[model samples]
Target chain A: MSCNLTEKVSLLVDGELSPVETRAIERHLLTCIECQQARADFLNLRQQISAYTPALNTQVQQRALASVLAKQGRAATRASAQAATPEAGRRPARIFGVPAMPFAIGMLITAAVALIVTSFVFYIVFQQAERDRQQATNTQANSSREQTATVNQPPNTNNDNSKANTFGASDEAANGKQSVDQSQQQRARGPVNSESENRQTFAANARRVRSKRPASSGTALARNAGINAPLDLHVPELLPPHEASAPRYITINATAPVAAPVRPVDAGTLAARHVEQAGLLLRAFRNARTVEQDAAADLSYEKRRARQLLYQNIVLRREAANEGNVQLASLLDSLEPILIDIANLPDQPHADDVRAIRERIGRKNLVALLEVNSTALARAYE
Target chain B: MASEDAEFTMLFQEFYPSLCRFLECLLGGRASVAQDLAQESFLQLHRTVWGTIPVGEARFWLYRVARNLALNEFRRGETRHRLFDRVVEALRPRTQTPEEEYETQERQELVLSMLKGLPEDQRTALLLREQEQLSYREIAEVLDVSESKVKTDIFRARTALRERWAQRVRAIGASVR
Candidate 1:
């Protein structure tokens, strides 16, 4: 039977034993023949196992190493190629860490939204413009009808009746009628007064007539005419030169020059006139500092004129807004407050108040805007 | 990454032939299968755990993976039959040879037969210890067993191989007579 320490001899062959254990196994091997034989047998077994497969030749070792390295190179190349595929392949580019497709989609959506909003705003603006245009056309048509009615009216003989009947016509037509009636009454008196005296009397009567008329009478008359009937005969002198020769009580055809009244002022023409007048007032007010000596007299006239223009401004502004003339409406809207300030100024305004008004006009650049809009409106009407 | 690859290449060149030899002996002297398994083990190491594993542990890791692969080959049963057929073929005599070459071939045949007779674990332990020269601890690590088990397996394998070799020699002596 083999010695029990033969297992220790196997460990000993592998040098797995401690030095003390090695010395002990060596001593035992010197004394025991069976352990010595087992040790030799174990050594022989290790030698046989080592020799069982011959060591590969250098050529074979090199070939094996080359094969492995070559495979590793190929595997590495494949891995790198895979890593590079995202940039080189079908993967989308990124912008600011966001994918290009989604970013482009976002941009397109934003553009679509902007387009919709812009189109909606334009629609609203155009709708307003159309409404204003229609209103202005209606105003022109009504004015044309009143002028046509006046042109068609028979000349009245009674002076008082003619005065009362012509009340509903435009202020220009009423003034023209009163002057013509007074001359006819003078003629009915059989030219008793001397011509120069009559001329002085007529001049005094014309001045008295103008002074008696309220500043808003023209606007009131127009408004009344829009609401009332045709009242009296039109003055021959008030008609255009071509229509002046036309017989009275003639049929007013569609092609008749009815719209060419004593003064052809539609809402657009009126707005342009208002803008021009307000620009002149603002310019005078803005430069009032240069003529401080005549400031009181000028302030009275300017304030009175501002009050009159303020009334016209409100009416024209409403008409402009109704016509969807946003540019004109907005200009008048801004001008209203300035006109109010000027109209409300004291007859003898303080220099500081005048300076403040001047500063406001300059700051708003109202003069330049008024000039530009005035030219645009005049061109539009012309 | 380049340095890691260089290190892996160095480790491969150092361990490939030894791994092939260990596998050849473990698989009962199937040289081609051993070589293939060795290459496959290295490939697996590079693919799965090259940089992740600690340095100097590749040798143990490779043997463990190769041992598992060889075990799978054994479980196939067809490989076992083929291995048996190969061992038998090594035993069959061919043309005349010099006495030294004949004896060397005879000894190799004897060793292969003795190895085939041992249990799988004992055979692996003995081959690792003798052919690969792994210590008992390393054999335990490669086999994933206790160091004491590796020692016992190696000792048992040696005892069994010695007995079988004696029996084969006696039988050969009788045939020669």
Candidate 2:
């Protein structure tokens, strides 16, 4: 027969019972042969199971431990490397040998600079536009003043108008000479008849001439015309009618063409225009040598133009230097020697002399330089 | 950290052998698989919960993890066919005399067959109690079952194995006759 205490034999062998419970189980086991046999079987089973598998050999244990440690070391190294460089597995893209971050920063800086330059250009353009608008207003006002002066003139001055209009259409240099003679004659006659009106007309004419040229040159031109004489005022009543009419006619006609409004040219625009013209002249001069046998006759016009350009170049170079335009000033300085060489050429320049100038032009690469600066300055100021 | 590693190493050295023996019986006498699962259990403990386990619970924890691994291997069914090969490998003679080695192998085969005959849970509980010498409560902890269940399982496993042992002995006597 099976004993109920038989199951407790398993727990008892495992020491799961308390001391009192162990005592009771032991007391029961003493008399119950079946319980006693169950306990023996459980104890025997433990011994059998324990001996079923052998312990790993010493060498195997050490090797297993070493493998574990080695693996752990490698894992630790990999983890630390990952921590040190987070992007170790995959690096970021680059542009033109520059890394992404710095390239992006450079692009941002360039965009900002371009934005500032664009705004500055807009500001200059607006200022130039405003100046043009104001100049138009002043031109209209000056034209009204001239019409008023013409309408308020004496009856004898009508005949003088016809004479003045004729003079206005004549050669500018001859008109300037006739003005000088008329001013001297008026000074000899002394002041008479509406001196204020004559003085007003004379002052207006002087201002008109001054507006068309540079300050120094305009002043010298005014002196050459004798319009600078303060006492040479027209006095119609103090003179013969013909003599009185002559001063007003000469003054009005001599200054008429000069009175039309001329747009003020800044040094930059002037230099750009000069470079453009010089580039054309030099290119044509170079092409003419190849295209024509009588290049000397064809070059006469260029030589005369070169002399005029040379004078303008000296003045412009000084202005550019004073304006602190080193690039333009340097270009003009290089151009000056070439202009002098062309201007000093004989009426029929020798083939050797022409070749020397052409060689110098090519050696300096002045044509390309001039073309680039010309377009650059025109784009900058336009 | 060094002290922690030292402690883990000490734990590994102390328990690795017993754990392997426990898993050997659990996995039907597969010694190599038992050693692998045992080492894997220790590695898992180190990786996941080394410093976090309570002091005495690491042994229970290791057995639990190893038991789970062995369970997974059982589910794969790959080990079933390899069971005979592994039994043969385990019984392979080494340093013992031929007569002693034969007797040892015979006894080991008998014990392994009886142990394998028990249900999986009962076998695991019984092995944890008998082989590891764990208390019923410790077996409960390792198997994550109630202590009463552990007690019942071990008792049932013992009764079953005793019956099988008696039958085998009687059969041997009959064959001798």
Candidate 3:
């Protein structure tokens, strides 16, 4: 018992012993000098410690209590002040310093709803603006193009219709310049800048037309007919003995004409070369009148070639008259004016103009003259 | 019928002076540091909301925080020792003869130096058991160890301190000869 009590003396001094153990230790201590000495030593050392361990003075203890109270008071005031103020966009309510997801979700939904409403308002406004624009377009459509042009044109121009036709030339240039081909059509439908860029642009267009157009064409008779080019008529260069090209400068007063140069046709055969040239002219006229709508531009190029042939055919037609080929001469007479009209036709000709030219050829029997005369001319080569 | 604040204030009134005295004793008589540690311990209690805590054991909680903070201060080295030394000097016994006062102070220094020299767990166990009058279970609560560990530490601290005290006295006697 003393052995057990001896080791537990610290616990005994600390009042840490169980009641049963304390009783056992205390009972043993009454008779056990060794246990008694152990108990005395533990108490004496503990008392010595207690004797020296410092205690805070009354003043220091009060100061600490006051400081704690002051801190609590300041916290209470700050929390109250925060509660009193209204928040404009306060942080969503929190629980234990974590934001409440439901409140955040509500704010997100509210923001989404507001954005959708604003977009809806903008959509309505844009749709109304579009309707107004379409209405204005219909109102303008009620007026004739002439009246609309009258309203849009500058004042004091009597020949404005003619001037718009003149401006069509420049419109072509500007149309040529627009990046999108569709933009050219839109700009053409509006008032144009008629002033600058015509001469160089027209020359450039002439060069382009020359490049793509089939080889030879007569210069168009219309002034500023940029659509036309110089003609290569392929005239046969033959004439009667007394004619200007007969290699003699003979005067009418000299009854005897100088001896005529030998006939260049190799057989003294003026009828044959005239017939061949006439056949070529007739073929040109036929090609120009070939009215395929999809190939109207090629047909237009053919017409320019025919106009050139007609200019050459005048000399050949005169030779045919000298031969007294009445059918061919009459055909040539009818074909000349038609060739000029076809040549001078707008770069994009009306279908009616082509149809009319076809009708005139049908009336004049030009196709029959070509067949008959070309057959007769081939005998010279045979 | 007490509000949370009133309950806390009641606890403070009950423990604040005792807590100051406890800190002073643990810190080797730095009265100012004792006041600070006591206040900081209560502040920690106040900062932790009342609901999550086991209010039934607020005393243990306060002492635990105060002891941890005081251990940190102790680990700060020379500063705490210097403070303790100045305090010991200030609280010098004025009524005693010069030799008697010297002997008292020398003994006090030897005991304090021994306590400080012991391992922290043993020192804390011995101090909580002896100076705070804490039970082994309560000392375990403050130090976050098992009650058995607390008992072992206290026994070890006491035995070592006693053995070293005897050794120190014998050395002093040898010197006197």
lDDT of 2 by residue, A1-382 (tens): 3688887776788777889999999999889999988888778777887777553554455466667666665655554455457584486434245334432343467567867997997688667766665544444433332321111233443322222211121224433344434544443332212446445534344334323422221111122222322222222232244754444322221222222222334556777778876775676556443213565655775687688789999998987887677988999999899999988888767788888999999998998788778767766767
Q: RMSD, each candidate, Å?
A: 43.9, 42.0, 51.0
DockQ of each model vs. true complex? 0.16, 0.13, 0.13
Residue B58 deviation, candidate 1, in Å?
Answer: 1.4
Superposed on the true interface residues, model 2 gives a C-alpha RMSD in angstroms of 29.4
- Candidate 3 per-residue lDDT over residues B38-91, each given as its tens digit: 899997787554434644367778888888888888888536446664674464
Q: How well is each residue in B1-177 modelled by candidate 2, as lDDT tens digits?
A: 554565576566557777877887887777777777787888777755666664356767889999999999998875545665556365443658989878887888788789889899999998887776666766787888998898888888889988888899899999999
lDDT scores for all predictions? 0.64, 0.64, 0.54
Q: What does fnat come to for each candidate? A: 0.47, 0.36, 0.36
Error of 3 at A219 (Å): 99
Q: What is the TM-score of chain A alone in each candidate?
A: 0.31, 0.32, 0.28
Lowest lDDT sum, 10 consecutive residues, model 3 chain B, at B1-10
lDDT of 1 by residue, B25-115 (tens): 7787776677778888988887566766654467789999999999988887545446654553454334347786678777886788788
Consecutive 10-residue window with the lowest summed lDDT within model 3 chain A: A246-255
- Pick the winner on DockQ between candidates 1 and 3: 1
Alpha carbon lDDT of residue B88, candidate 1?
37
